[model samples]
Target: MAEGICCEFLKGLQKIKIAEELISLGKIACDIIIISLISQFKSIISMLFLGHLGDIELAGGSLSAGVANITGYSIVKGLAMGMEPICSQAYGAQELTVFRKIYKKTLRLVLVACFLISLLWLNIEPVFLLLGQNQAIISVAKVYITYSIPELIAQAYLNPLRIFMRTQNITKPLTISVTCAMIFHFPISYILAVYFNLGVRGVALASACNTVITILGSLTHLYLSRTAVRPWDRQAIDMRLEDWKPLLSLMVPSVFSVCLEWWWYEIMILLCGQLSDPQASVSAMGILMQTTALLYVFPFSLNQGLSTLVGQALGAEQPARAQRTAIMGIGVATVCGLLCFAFTIVVKNVWGKLYTGELEVLALTSAALPIVGICELGNSPQTASCGILTGSARPRIGACINFVSFYLVGLPVAVFMAFRLDMGFLGFWYGLAAAQASCACMMICIVVWTDWNHQAERARGLTQTTEEQASLLS
Candidate 1:
């Protein structure tokens, strides 16, 4: 009788342990997901304002935004991600100074990157013209891109700060900051764009103002919270140009991997601009992009959390734990993908109405929803797998896979379908789906066969080198 009781107690304890792990993961994941949603909402609000202006403005804004994402934001964001492996592992390894140094270095690098991207934005007009976009869209796009400059600079800083907080498991502050920023966005946008009559440029200024608020909020929270993360050491802010070499080594592949996938989507948008009815096609593509970006917050948050989790586990020298984190992340992402697929399908007919009311835009957007929704099913898992790779310090593999899947295979099929077969926007989306499917399959295989123990060793080596270099410089 006593033995039976002891066995039952052990079983209960095991269940509790499992439950605790899941809860911990869920809590962090959910907070980051909320933050991501709020960030996406900022874009949606801007689009809503633009959509209301006119179809031409909507198309122009969408194209310029797409171009900006590919040329500027994506590169900055990807380079900042180089900090993920560094900071997460440093936190796990209890190397606080190392984390601070890397953070400072990353900040400097991204600032320089912002300056370079600004140059690109300055000369964006000719690029649009050469690409054969409508002259009216080109003109409006130039103004929109011009006003969006501040927002671009703000993001260059915001992304690195967000990653810094995430590595320390300090997410609630980020969530709160972003929420406050988003809440402030709507009224500010209405006042500037409508009441003040600044038009599209007003909308852009409002967005920049909101981002500044978000930055201030996040900085204030971080400075005030004594228990959340470690304090900054003033000494670590030295101009450590040497540190960037190793970081950039990881960053180059990381940038390419992220840019390839992002640029592919932008290519789709550009292709839509080339369709017979440019206005309707571009408007539909814009709506679909906004919708997917909203739904994408889930998997993307999963990616961020999983990267931190796996990086920490590996840094702590627990290969098995890292492997398990990867598996659990995949499970969560798959479920999110399935749920998104179902919801998008149910809302397909009415989804367009949320963005626009034009008969042509509504019809085209509704038709594209199914394809976009189905793409989400594959995209979620693929995105999770990419997160795993980021954590494992193997971004080069991801870069190679993305290039091959998206460019070598998917691009050709998309072009053939959209242009040759006359499938138009539907065919463009189908090509995206195919790319997602292929990337997911390859990434899944890579994750399954990954040697987590080896990755841990690699992480240790990377951190050890950073520590050594820091000591030498000091």
Candidate 2:
């Protein structure tokens, strides 16, 4: 009877522990989702301001922004993600020195990359001219890109800082900083665009100003917070070329993984222009893409939170905890996927109305929403598994899986169905659904098969001091 009672108590304790994990994950995910929404809102505000300027300004700004995302922002963001494992693991291991070195290294790498990308931004006019773009559009794009250089530089600092804080579970400061910056964005944008009449140039400047404000706010918070890592700590200043190899190894694959997926969406947009009813199809596609992006915030938030939790667990030498976290994250992501599926189906008919009044666009969007829903079912888990892989320091696997699923499998299916099968716009979405499903399946399999104990050992190596690693190697 005593033994039976003890077993019951242990089970109850385990249940409480599971509940605690869920609460922690939910809190972190909520903060991340809020941050993402605010960032999206800022972009919307910038676009709205651009639209007020003129049709030319709006079109040019949109075009420039897309190009910048594909070439500049995506790469920087991907590179910055390399810091996740290092920072999170080091923080968990209580190795503050390694964490600081990785942060500085990542920041420097991003800045160098931005400098190179800015050169490309500067020469966009010539490139667009070469591609036979309209002279007027090229002129506007030139101005928009030129003035957006400051924003690029700001991202270089902001991305690293975000990762640095997030790994340590210091999310409130980030949320507060971004919120304060967003509040200032509207007035700053108005004064620069309307009051000064700088037009698109002013709008770009305002965006940069707000981003700088966010960076400053984050730094100030870090400085003041006793629990947070000191951004200005002098002891964490050591750097060496040899120390950079591990970061680069992770960063390059991460770039490919991110860019491949991002570029695929852009490619789909290009494909829409080739459809028979290009105008309606492109418009509908745009609306559906926006819907997908908005819904994606939930899964992506889980992705971020899971990566941090798993990394911390492994770094602290708790393989079982890491495995459990991965499982819980996948389960949560599955629920999110189901919710997204229901949402798309329920809103299918009226969703397009929010974006357009055209009957043709509305009809196309309604038909496509179901397939997009199916894609989300796959995307949520696939994304969560990506976090698992990232936390385990195996981003190359994700990159390879993405390439095969999207380009090799999905692309051919899309072309055959759309052009040859005469399915048109719907065919494109069906192809995406196929890719997402396959990707998710493969990712989940890999995650389930992961050697958590091995990953814990790897984390130890990653967070080790140079001498410690060298001794181990020898």
Candidate 3:
């Protein structure tokens, strides 16, 4: 009896150890998932609310989102991408002076960009009209555009602060910030749109309000960074043209290339709305898209975690370790992708049914499910590869690869297969299979050709090469 008890105790201890490991992993997966989910949740809210306004409004919202989301997300996330590598490397080397300087400049950049965005909002109606959208849509979209504009500034500041914490793996606060924002934004948006009958303009205002609230909270969280802050230099001034060149060089290509990807998505929505069943297509796809986007949190989070670890590791001159970390992240993402795959394949129709009872919409989404799942499988590896490259500060290559894979190759082929053949919504989604598949193939190629073994060495050389090009500024 004592022997049995002893054996049971040992088994319990083993289980505890296993549980700890899983918990550690869960934290990473959770952080990224939260980041992606919270960021995209506003869109989900807008979609759900707008979905109720009949198919025309639903179609308009999706088109607006596709155009608006691509514009907003690509620009904001593009700039935000700059924050991760810069902070990771700076923090890795314990360079607080540089970090502060970078922060200041980045903040200035963000503020300036936001002002420009505000002006754009003022003139967005004519711009939409010029783009050949319906007159009514052009009118409605202006309000949403105005609301989205103010949020950009908030996101600019918020991105740096959130990413700064992310480098330190302090994601709980960011998560809370997003949660609180949603809390404030959702009911408020609902009240404005439904109760007050403010319509789409209310959505714009609610989103802007949400951004301000979240940004303030995120800024407050940064106080902790000062406490955890290592002993470092002061005089938060740097004429370090060298420091920024690397960041900008890496960022530009990525920004330009993704423009195409964004265009394809935005344009697809535009085209989808012109379809025979615009309302059904938009409502059904909108729900499914949000579901897929939410599920995307895990893989996207894995990508962020891998980038953080790998970038820091590369900064610390441990390229082999970084490579292994990337592999592990991919492995984890692949597993999660499989789960999402099953969810979409086996239970997507179930999800569609739960979200709405419309037989027509359900039928469309059901037809699209198989293609969507397949897209995830291809997208997971490619998505994770984005982090792998960003860690190396070699974003241009990834960007170019994605551009070719998605636009030059993916978009044209997809459109032909879908529209030319009248494959309908299913055809449209099937095209992504080609795009994502090509992207996956290209990203894999880029990763393999890049020297994971000497990533740290490459980083050091990048610093040197950057210095050689110009004098450091003050």
Q: Largest TM-score belongs to which candidate?
A: 2
Tens digits of per-residue lDDT, candidate 3, 285-369, equal: 6776666677667767777777777777776777766766666666666777677788788886687887789998999888888
What TM-score would every model get versus the actual structure?
Answer: 0.89, 0.97, 0.83
Q: Please give the clash total of every predicted structure, in order.
A: 0, 0, 3
For residue 248, give model 3's deviation from the true position in Å.
1.5
Who wins the lDDT comparison?
2
lDDT preference between candidates 1 and 3, better one: 1
| lDDT per residue as tens, model 1, 253-293 | 88998899888877887788788988899888878887888
Q: Mind giving the per-residue lDDT tens digits that candidate 2 earns over 1-474? A: 999999999999878978888988988899999999999899999999999999989988988988889989999999999888888888888898888888988988999999999999998887667646687878898999889999999999999999899998988888999999999999999999999989999999998998999899999988878888875556554567566678887899999999999999988888988989999988998899889989999999999999899999988999988998999999999999999999999999999999889999999999999899999999999999999888877888999999999999888888889999999999999889989999999999999999899889888988886654433223
The local distance difference test score of model 2 is 0.89
Model 1 spans > 4 angstroms off: 1-17, 51-60, 133-139, 194-198, 236-242, 273-280, 353-367, 419-422, 467-474
Clashing pairs for predicted structure model 2, backbone only: none
- Stretches of candidate 2 exceeding 4 Å from the true structure: 130-132, 235-240, 466-474
Candidate 2 local lDDT, residue 357? 95
